[model samples]
Target: MTSRDTVTDPLPSGRGAALPDGGGVPASPPIPPRLLTDLIDSAVRDHGERRAIDFLGRRWTYAEIGALVDRAAAGLQAMGVGPDVRFGLCLPNTPYFVILYFAALRCGATIVNFNPLYVEHELRHQIRDSGTTVMAVIDVASIHAKVAAVAEESGLEKIIVCPLADILPTFTSLLYRLFKRSEIARWPADARHMAFGDLTRANPASFKPVAVTPDDVAVLQYTGGTTGVPKGAMLTHANLTANSHQMTLHVGHGAEANDRIMGVLPMFHVFALTTVLNFSVDTAAEMILLPRFELKQFLKTVKRTRPTKLLAVPTMLTALNKAAASQDVHFDDLDFVVSGGAPLPFDVRQEFERVTGARVVEGYGLSETSPILTCNPITGVVKDNSAGPPFPGTTLEIRSLDDPHRIMPQGERGEVCARGPQVMKGYWNKPEETEKVFVDGAIRTGDVGYLDEDGYLFLVDRIKDVIICGGYNVYPRVIEEALYEHPAILEAVVIGVKDDYRGQAPKAFVVLRPGQSASTAEIAEFLKTRLSKIELPREIEIRQSLPKTLIGKLSKKELVAEEAKKAAG
Candidate 1:
């Protein structure tokens, strides 16, 4: 598909405008909109000198950012990255990440965003599964080891290593490397891959934008599979662009183009991708980047940046509130705290507002929906625990799990399904899995929720065993597989347990091998480097045996039920 296919004239002012067809204007399309690339181009042309991203201590203007993105696109073209090529981006929330992301899109390549915390095995699996030919990674030692392990095996021909402080001056780079060695050790080595800086500096700051259609796959966000493997959700340009516009409209007058946004969430996650990165770019707002969320650093950044908008999960909000209470940090500048990636407990929301003086607005979506389906209206009266109302032009219906075709009436909880342009095209190369979720024309959100008389959504439970901690989705199967890696662990089952802060935290029930022994702390420490903090279990329970289904398969549902009963008693 060509750029001509994606770019359409703005629609007339109306409730919902029709989207253009694949090549020309359609009779009636869902919300007519510009492509994501067009939005960036306009930002660059209008806000060329405006601050686009602030990282560490350096700031990048829109002109500088656009030039860098173009150079990166040129470099990728030089490396044979073009239409349909899947390029892996493994950097954190930094200017390099934004550059590479838009650059790949500009080249019409599908971006495969990889979690930087993935172990070598997980990284290898994603690289192989996505069939990525090029990977742009942070320049850290651990990442180097993982990339080296799978570079040749996965058919990855090129690796681009970006320094954590490359945009900073020479002295700052030296100090950053010396002071941040422990955390930065995960970056790849200098010799293993081309440096992002050198490549961009050498390349010309001009490249032809590839013709892309709205239906062209822009990003392939991978999610944990029910079959014990991960698959990429094919989110097309139309999917992402439409979702961003939907969110922008839903936010209403709360956020303006001049408002600065705190981007503490990882760009790899779809929540941050749409709300923080894409939304900020579309509005021509400055994004204050935090590579990772550390309480002290996070507080310091917020204090320094004084951002007007904040997007985060319940766990991050809980931690920030605790830190604010102790440190006396001022959050009067924050306009709204947008929460997602998990359910927001009522108490947590209340406490956060009491402590920070900011209202928390909860939203809901999955990776397959370009991540934003329902959100709290910026000006509406909010229900205590609802995820607000559906965004403009989006339709939500809860259907019985057994009969997906039958939509349940309001106030009755069932599987939440959504229909909109933001819905993904399909799962990459997984036709059966794609068919199972995409029924009729709507996407089945595997989450169970219901709508009230006021059209507000209240989430009851997740149909899938996915644990969300600190706004990141943590699959129980992934954690259980990690537990099995320990020689002492004979069998293990992981489940999400209620937490005062994080909504739900992972808890592992383990059975030791005959005569083998290991403590909870030991297992926790063992998995620390292998998984991100959100994926780690809060507690580990040594079990003589785990309850199983009638077929004898280890059942997490039974374990959750027993835990619930124990807690009630």
Candidate 2:
């Protein structure tokens, strides 16, 4: 593989063998063809009548979902949406999202995901930057106003409104309209505002299929833009389809077409977009969709649905574990759990597994890689403090921080680099930024980690996140892991704070477990044996809860900003 090659090479045979430390299961099964739209048609052909989406007690079979997708695709095509036209999707995890996602792909249009919670300015900037043509927004009052206000300025040609209860059964829809109507966002009355129902009901037949190839851009996934203005990561059809195949090869073992997977994370996030939604469509498994995470509602849904598998994050797992202590939550039916989007603490992993009686394995990835790069094998041994091995057909290396061009030997901590069929074509329209991150056909994951002799990877911290206290590198994760070991600590994060002598020192934020308490001195004393002297936090702050990212991962960035504001005040 090289930077000059536009398409990633296909995986070779014997590439899926079990890793040495955990003993490989078997060579990866033959990979299916690389086409994103094919997943929908194949699932319908194989298991047409099986449940495809279970939302708020409303269920839609695969046959029904496929029919809706075809109708939506036909309707989108009729509305002048064609190949390469940028389509904006701004909705939560509902049946509307699933239908519109596959429908856009089926129509050969590039899908651009938007966080439904974005304000007017944020939405305007993304729409103007991505050059979106048709925007699909949720029928909420605030969201509709924001989109409508910026439509002309952003050069949006058309707008579609999807109701939260569009796909619900008639009775359920009536109930939602009656009781939840006030809470639901109201739709706009503009001539340009058309309902999702109108789109599907008006066109009940399939449209002509366009000639889309693997090289065509499928998605314009935007980065968080922590460094600067957000840039869209251009993921081609081959990149998404190949990454989906690689994920299935690693985690799809024994997942039958009839199995059910929980879709709790918002679909707008790339982690859920690829792993949960795309993976379920690839495996023909039913997805239990929850628009948002509510503690009581999540527990009830789990009891009623008994999903076979769940794709989760560390914060979600910690919340579930906390809920299990006081509430009678049922997780015994779950086969396994896959956690990603952030590092999974060893204590959180152990507590979650013990309560649910299921293996909780952590995976690592970024949005630019179509989201999956490495994962702990479900059927193999899960190494402690490691994110397991690289996915089958994926290549990983640790490079020096000072000189990224130089690859470091195993066991040496450095920047984690990955090259695979999953890496994005490049950052959309940012050639210089893309060139900086991608070299020799590999994507530099800003994360810092090292590989053991047996090829298992152990994460240290992000390159930008490493705190230099008194000239000694202090990795926050090591301290956070030690905090989790304490019975009273439920969640923790460490960030560097300015100091008079040490230049910058570590500050700990602790969230105590329910009904338990621990002082800052007690926490520091407990970590004395685990972390070196310089790695210890200079100050500890106790709070009810720490801030989290949109996907619920503990966000050190938010904590750092909050601390900075407090210092200024």
Candidate 3:
């Protein structure tokens, strides 16, 4: 789409500009009424021979990707998977994940993303909640065991397994087998269920795409569920497509089709799902995929790929800076770093700029809004700590957290509310919860932030006690409940502590039952099966008593303050 077609005008302060036309003022491509099938087909026809995805020394061109997607779609069609069916994707970051995601979309199916690290209980909860009947997972023995344990209980009828080296080079496959197998377990025996190779080989490389509308459900994204249970936020094709367009306009001046983007962020998260996956697809840019973020591996990948732009959370940036400082490494080719998903600490942003010699810009959004609302401008002027101005065709307002109807004045901290095309339709199957967040057509992000006089957004704190550790959201209550399940633990309060690389790590203060004893390592290991890696506490403090409020309720705020004081000393 042409720059003029995408935006009405630049921001009033001239901090933001319209998305630049690639070569000239070409006519804007019409936004598809439906997503998934239409976008993939069109990209394949237009950029068929171009490389679309790069991973572990292997690449997949658009034409090759299209063929694989077609076969997968046909295979799914044969399995009676179509509209209204929920398909769970439990694989890591790989080309197969991308292909299956689009293929399922082609058949008018809803994708339910599951973290690969989830155990049996966590897997069962999501599967039963989403009513997922089929799952596409990696051929890892531990993961397969977990899936098997939950399949019957959750009513999962079929399991499709893909190998890690399905697309990797022969030598790399050997290397992985010799070294990485113990870390990422291999499951040759589980290949008996449904081989991805057989599915792709047996099906034809062609399938009819399903017709859908803007309102049709595309993705059922589940949140951290800090309150009670994890719930899916129902996002339509229009919601995602509109957000992509809005973000494209917000940061399009310097980004080009030829620019290389690092896709280190997990695609399962909403921020990366839209920015790294869909945005890269829209711009026809090549993406360098990292399966998981390991400091050494990530640095090596960055040095090899030399990506010009990066979309990462604050934790990733912190890690990059620490690695560079401790190892004396350098990153001279990076152009810009975009931080989101959690509030970016001022210190991390400053250190990243000093180490990488690139601007680290911050943005803000929620899963309910296709995950992007504001971003620092790529041209004119930039703001260091603020999530620079709202994207085109978007409006932002701060309202009291207790009273959503009252709009707070500028520079005053309150709940951030957003209104734009990117806003989701509602939460999946929860009308009461949906009504609570959607007020006057604006999505109420439980995050508390304020807008300055110039319209730049500055986050203050989260209304919910959602702890962000290494870029993953850890609900304090979830961890506390898990600890409470232990017989030795009487009461527990979880809080975040500053860390050099992980941004924040969970620290639990526990009041054990009288005369009961447990080591920190013991408690951590006990909760490992119940919680994800990121949610586990780095340290546990056994306390004789926990501070309580006037009404005898646990006070986590006081604990956080005490920890901050200790750090300062």
Candidate 4:
């Protein structure tokens, strides 16, 4: 069978054959369609006294959080937030992200998640593109100032300013107000601005409920992926909730009933939105929240909070491995850390497991599919370097590169396409782009990979990232993985650069671990046996650090542009 015109995957693992009618036996119970708002209500009802959030020693129980959500929802409604209103959340991982997220949804408004690190121009573009009228941001000058400028330029209606020090423990809040005063911004006294404390009032009587449906747009998750063109994936309530359920099914429950998840990944990012935030809320787990992934803070969070599970990007594992080499660090309470949001190099996983004595499970998905389509099972035979298998309601099909409609034979490399309920409705308001991305009902994953006969996905690299070296396809990930096998290399990034001999050739940049070094020649020599001549990078440059996305994935966009500029000049 062939896909029509164009379009996408998910195949269940551990199954000899898929069910006849485009279905498969779920590894666990199927996730029923539901509203994202329902997750909070159920958690509060069943686990009211359970600790819901822990930020800088300040804690809130599920009941407390639910009450806050109620007040915020009422306030949001009074501020004219309801169906069709796009509410933007510009926040780091904090209690505010939790409250505002559900409150906006509870008001029957669609949320547009914004990265607080975005510059004014980036913020302006998304604000206009997403039609975000109201936004909530922290009082930190660096974030709020930019958003404020963007609001002025982009016609945003209201700003709910949250104080940085207000959410901390009393003594810590005092210290922050005294010492970190420079970081806070002074909001202009105007009608456009409101305090977060005021926005979430203490009156439950004023709260009015709006009926939320499973298909309502919950969040407009922006993803550029490898394409470099930012488009908002319209993730609905069902899409977000079902993916969270899929994660629970895949990971199952650890031996202990109480689980604390490390929330270092930014809440704005879909991976964390589903795994850390949504997953934790549904399971009644305490979220040990950090504003960002500072290495010292992460190690302290692991030891201090005793997080039973963590969802981390590759860079976090690298930092932990580097930290463990210097001093004693314990991850004893962690059942296992699931690595996603980027490819997990074998050496990084191996070293993390060996040094900290914590298990690492790798998963794969994109922002378009509610961010999780496949994951390595928590307590099962996990294949090394493969992104495990499809989640319970997903089907994966690998289509030929030349003709995407044709399904590739088993064990052959091609583009992965998936069909599942967890997939987004489409790109927001961009019908042409949306149509281009979908072919035959499956969401086309631009990733180049193949599924093994046993149904495990082994991703090669992004199709756009593949270098056509002397008319032969050469994957940068292959060379980068080889570079990781070296003792000194801490991080590796390879990008296709313009070459006179070949159309495009691979160029490598690496950062060495502390007190460890190897010249380009030594690294080239190391890769001689492992890689073919064509797979070798044209030139290797050693750098103190490499570029990374805010979520900590090693980025190739900057390097690609830098090389292009040099070539143009």
Give the TM-score ranking, best first. 3, 1, 4, 2
The positional error of residue 296 in candidate 1, measured at the CA in angstroms, is 1.5
Q: Which candidate is the best by lDDT?
A: 4
Which of candidates 3 and 4 reaches a greater TM-score? 3
Residue-level lDDT of model 2, residues 45-152, one tens digit each, is: 888988899998889988999998999999998887888699999888998889999898888999999887765666888898888989998877677777888899
lDDT of the candidates, in the order given? 0.78, 0.78, 0.76, 0.81
lDDT of 2 at 556: 84
Q: Tell me the TM-score of each prediction against the true structure.
A: 0.89, 0.78, 0.90, 0.79
Compared to the true structure, candidate 2 yields what TM-score?
0.78
| Tens digits of per-residue lDDT for model 4, 119-219 | 56668889999999999999999889888887877979999999988899999999889999898899999999999988877476887778878777899
lDDT of 3 by residue, 1-569 (tens): 11122323221112133322111111233333346566667668888877888897688877888899889989888777799899889977788788888878878899988888987888998999899988988877788778877887789988888888667878998888778777554444543367778777645644655776666778888885436357898877777877777667776642244667788888888888888888777666678888888888877877777787899888788777777777754467677888887778888888888887887888877777888888887665667667777866667878877787678877888888776556666778887887777655567777788888787888877777677776677787788989999989999999889876677888999988988988888898899988888888888999999999999999887898999999999
Question: Lowest lDDT 10-mer window, candidate 2?
Answer: 11-20
Better of 1 and 3 by lDDT: 1
- The better candidate by TM-score, 2 or 4, is 4
Alpha-carbon shift of residue 482 in model 1 (angstroms): 3.4
RMSD of each: 4.9, 11.4, 5.8, 11.3
RMSD (Cα, Å) of model 2: 11.4
Local distance difference test, candidate 1: 0.78
